[model samples]
Target: MRYTVVLSYAFTPAWLSLSRDERNAMEEQYIQPVFAKYADQVAARFFDAEAFHAQHTDFALLETEDLQAYYHLVEELRDTPLISRQYLTFTDIRIGVEGGYRTFEVLTRARE
Candidate 1:
């Protein structure tokens, strides 16, 4: 089964206070590596929503078949400066499976 997780998060003042170079460095040193480590197990796409939204500044749309790897990815991210040092604040997360109704339908047929 494949799962799609939408993680909505905001960029804190601390993050904006950093210079472009510093921000790039932070992503390179902390954020990018974690995603790279989970590259095979998860597919991630980040969206910039600051201009369009009021509550959250950005969101990551992640798709994965392996929940364990996804969980580990989150754990690693929590340890990074992005979250630990308050660079990014998570606002909400929505998890679901595409075509989820089909799974139930299949189960219903099997039981019939």
Candidate 2:
């Protein structure tokens, strides 16, 4: 089974204070390493939504087969400056399983 998680976050004033180069450097130094650690278990893609939305500035789409690894990935990120120093504030998280209904139906139904 595969799980998809959408994590929405907004940049705080602290983040805006940084130059573009600083932001990119921070992402590379802090964020990228966490993702790289879980590369085999989880896949992540980031999207910018500040232009389209009022609340969230960005959202990350993460697909994973291993929930434990995903959980660890988030834990590691939480310790980074992005979250610890209030550079980014997490607003919401939505998790779903791809084609999960079929899997549940098979597991819950009576067998002949």
Model 1 is weakest, by summed lDDT over 10 consecutive residues, at 98-107
Flag regions of model 1 displaced more than 4 Å.
Answer: none
* Clashing residue pairs, backbone N/CA/C < 3 A, model 1: none
Colliding residue pairs in candidate 2: none
lDDT of 1: 0.95
- Residues 16-79, model 2: lDDT tens digits: 9999999999999999999999999999999999999999999999999999999999999999
Error of 2 at 29 (Å): 0.6
| Model 2: lDDT to the true structure | 0.96
- Clashing residue pair totals per candidate (backbone < 3 A): 0, 0
* Model 2 Cα shift for residue 99 (angstroms): 0.5
lDDT of 1 by residue, 4-111 (tens): 999999999999999999999999999999999999999999999999999999999999999999999999999998899999989999999978899889999999
